[model samples]
Target chain A: MDEIIRINHITKEFRVPDRHEGLRGSIRDLFSRSYHTVHAVDDISISIAQGEIVGYLGPNGAGKSTTIKMMAGVLEPTSGEILVNGCVPYKNRTRNAQNIGVVFGQRSQLWWALPLVESFRLLKDIYQITDAQYDEMLALYRSLVDIEPLLHKPVRQMSLGQRTLSDILAAFLHDPKIVFLDEPTIGLDVSMKAKIRTLIHELNRRKNTTVILTTHDMGDVDALCRRIVIIDKGKMLYDNDIEHLKKFFGAYRTLKLRVKGDLSEQAKRIAAELPECSVSANENWISVLVNEDKQKVISVLSQLQKSYDIRDMQLEEISSEDVIKRIYEGGVV
Target chain B: MKRKGFRFYLRIYFKILAQDLKSKMSYRADFIISTVGMIFTNIAGFVSFWIMFRNFPSISGYSYHEMLFLYGFSLLSVTPTQCMLDNNWNLRQQVYSGDFIKYCFRPINLFFYYESEIFDAKGLGQLAFGIGTLVYAWAKLGLAVTPLAVLKLLVFLAGASFVMAALQTAAAASCFWIENSFYVLDLAFRFRDYAKYPITIFSPVFRFIFTYIIPIAFIAYYPGMMVLRPSEVSLLSWLSPLIGAVFFYLAYRFWMYGASKFNSTGS
Candidate 1:
């Protein structure tokens, strides 16, 4: 595989006006205006190979979008360098744009009121794609998905899922070297999510197109990405394959319990008692990441049973979501 | 390997324009209402002119037909911008919402891409109304439609259209710097009203401002003067097309500067 993207210690800083609270403060602010810098992406370097589906994961406001924007040539990094397919993206944006496609999840790139195919045709002309290439892509789309039904449907009338699907297809139509999908599976149902994931995976396999996807859904990461990069607070936290990430929280099994008392209090108690395991509460379910090397699950359960009433419990392996949560919570990275 | 030059862009432009028209035509009622509404608005404006002319033979040195010619030229000049540059009006909203990234993602020029986003059909109504007024006024003034006159008119119209689009683009490009650029663009829109009247009626300072500062004079007033009173028109009137071309180039440069300063809204 070829290294198509090379990011070297890139940092993007935004200077926002320091707004005042009230009338007097605002008046004073106008007299002496102030600005503070926000480091959206700080000293992050990543080298991505061609034909790789890399899940770029982060919590909300976690610099994932800033990184993606830099890659897509939408924003220039305040410091350092970023090269995509041997071109500095922001400097040679038009040239970089020739080799990349971007889909910002919150907005549709499609013509809002036009039929879906019209947008595709417009893209065809913009990309200057040959007729044969356009028809072949259309045939590929039709074969992979039941796209014929939605081809003539106006984009505004289509459901969110349908619109997202169409948008993904549009991004790939030009056969760009890379595609940046920001939250591609956001606000989607399970079935729709599955379909999109499958479509992305199939496209990657068929075309060997590099995919950089920013998503919150761990399910999407599990289904599509072979490797994942996690960032938090403008800093890189983790970057490795899924299995390695899971193994980072070695021999950990999730001990889920439906307790009688307040979930938070119970969680705290369990945390105090176990000492080695990480415990978190959500509604009535209290989940504990119990390390088998440190303590046996049976013993931990028996100890919990002695103090509190455990109505129901289940033992399972640590999931990717838990690993992400642990990293997000600044627990075991 | 990349297609370059005017022909490629022209082909793509027509395709985008077709898509825009197709999308707009879907709402048949809205299309009819807006187009008809525009024509009616122009008619009401014409009625106001008729009332003014009926009360007095001439407001300044110009006759009723000359006033109509000035008004007609203003309308013709503005029609191109109204038709093609409607997307610039919403650029602030698009930028704030981060939807403007769509322009950055395309391989084409950003300004060209923005222009291709939509085609305003309501502008056709204005175009029709403008042509009708100019023809009526021209016949009343007894101005013969010679090839030389038509060629000169074509140049003036093109020049005026470029100026109109340039001003709009320059105003809209401020969205990249400020949060809301509507006020700035509104000022530009208000200045268009000044072009419909004779600048000679106003004070020298204002005349200079309209001519040099904002260049609203070239949009219609100067061109109108060039056509109606070629002997009395100044040398500046002959340079309307040059001024327009230069102004448009400056506006385009400003747009590029603003875009470079663009730190897109956080996603």
Candidate 2:
């Protein structure tokens, strides 16, 4: 649980020229230049520990990529400090890069025209990996990600899923202590997504590699991360364990009731009698939001059954997507 | 580490260069056509000068062969810098596409990333043409072939390449602020135009500026003067290359500063 990364009050701003539309405005812009500052990453701080897979969740343009770039030393913070493995990422980039790996899902770090193995070899030279160590890591990556068919194929010819898998493998081949994966499984099929998730989990468990992942896929969060940090509008809204997030903001659970003899009125009365529930009727099924604890699920179902002949019933727990939607809509936690 | 260890990096660098060459060779016909086209384009400039010299016989106090020496050496000094550092010419695209990120994470000096991609097939063609022109000028001018003159010429050529590479790198590094300043590269080559002739034809102050401020004269004129053993070629001729070396160092420092700015701006 030792801290591997410490980001303290990091902020980034960009000065963008103000340009107007049309020919006249373009001419004026050329002569009299003006600019406005964009606050891409606001003052924010978060620390991640060793072997922890934390979900950095945010919508597009919410500064997720900016933060990852800063952490990876691809960009410097406008203000404040970032320390990875006890070194400033920007000032000591080469030293910091030696122990860290990064992958941007939108871009391939692998050489586009070369075979995947060739790109890996180039990386080995760039990172100065020993021959034995390179072979060992290549073997491990091949076993974990099914990269055998991919090693010989040119990167330009590989499918998106194949390329993504290769990219993930390349990022970890150097045995970096900490890896930043930005949308690692983006644009992948269901099976590919599952395979990547398993590979990530295996890497973390086997190597104790700290991972910081920024993804729009909620399934990625549910499947891999035990902790989550959500940011929006360049501000951190929540940072805690997944269970706490579900408990704090996961307010409503759905109950689906199917009753006999069109007993719609009786179901409504039953729902009304239970003040904690909100009722909605559709066809022969009545749906209710049970606001009480899940312990009350049985009681609520029994009450509905006693009043009306129950044909079938179903219950669903609140999902992470629902929790995120509520948070985005400014729901109280 | 020992000085020999630096050679290891250079060896690896050439491997990468070989890989790039292989990739470029994939387009075989285009490569051949471009190589031929480059020779024709360079010859066109010399052809214009030959026609001018044929009519007038001399420009100011210099003859045709003497001017060819200046032209040939200037082009020769520039080819090594331009061809080896071709990546600098595309710095605008690198900045716009964020490919600079690749260099930021590497354990090597970022300057090498900008320097290594400079050599390509077109540059090799230019180098061939420059050398051919130099040999032609040497034979026609009846230039003195003393061992000392040859030694000084080699030293001057090396210093000239260093200075030219540094200037090109500085021009490329300016893209960090201006973003898409490929025009700066164009401006640099325009100044190279000044090196195609002897600086002795200009006023003293103009000569000093080209030699000291821009150091274009170091790349061609001073070296040409040293080889020709002109009376004006004093001890100052030997020291002029130091100007090129110092400018190279300053340009390198500026490139690092610009890289730092890129890291902060992230544009």
Best by TM-score: 1
lDDT of 2 by residue, A1-333 (tens): 799999999888888789989999999998999999888888889999999999999877788878887877767888989999988877777777788888787678777777788788777877888899998887778677667789888888999988888888888888998988989888899999999999989988888999999898878988999999888767777788988876664556778888776657756776678777777788767878776654377788777667678888888766555566668787544
Look at candidate 1 and tell me the lDDT of residue A172: 97
Score candidate 1 by lDDT. Answer: 0.87
Candidate 1 structure quality by residue, lDDT tens digits, A237-303: 8888877775667688888999898999889988888788888999969998888888989999898
Task: For candidate 1, give the DockQ.
Answer: 0.64
Docking class of 1: medium
Chain A TM-score per model, please list them. Answer: 0.90, 0.80
DockQ, all candidates in order: 0.64, 0.29
Complex DockQ, candidate 2: 0.29
- Candidate 1 collision pairs: none
The stretch of ten residues in a row with the least summed lDDT in candidate 2 chain A is A317-326
Which 10 consecutive positions of candidate 1 chain A have the poorest summed lDDT?
Answer: A324-333
Q: How many clashing pairs in candidate 2?
A: 6
Report the Cα lDDT for candidate 2: 0.80
Model 1 Cα shift for residue B204 (angstroms): 2.6
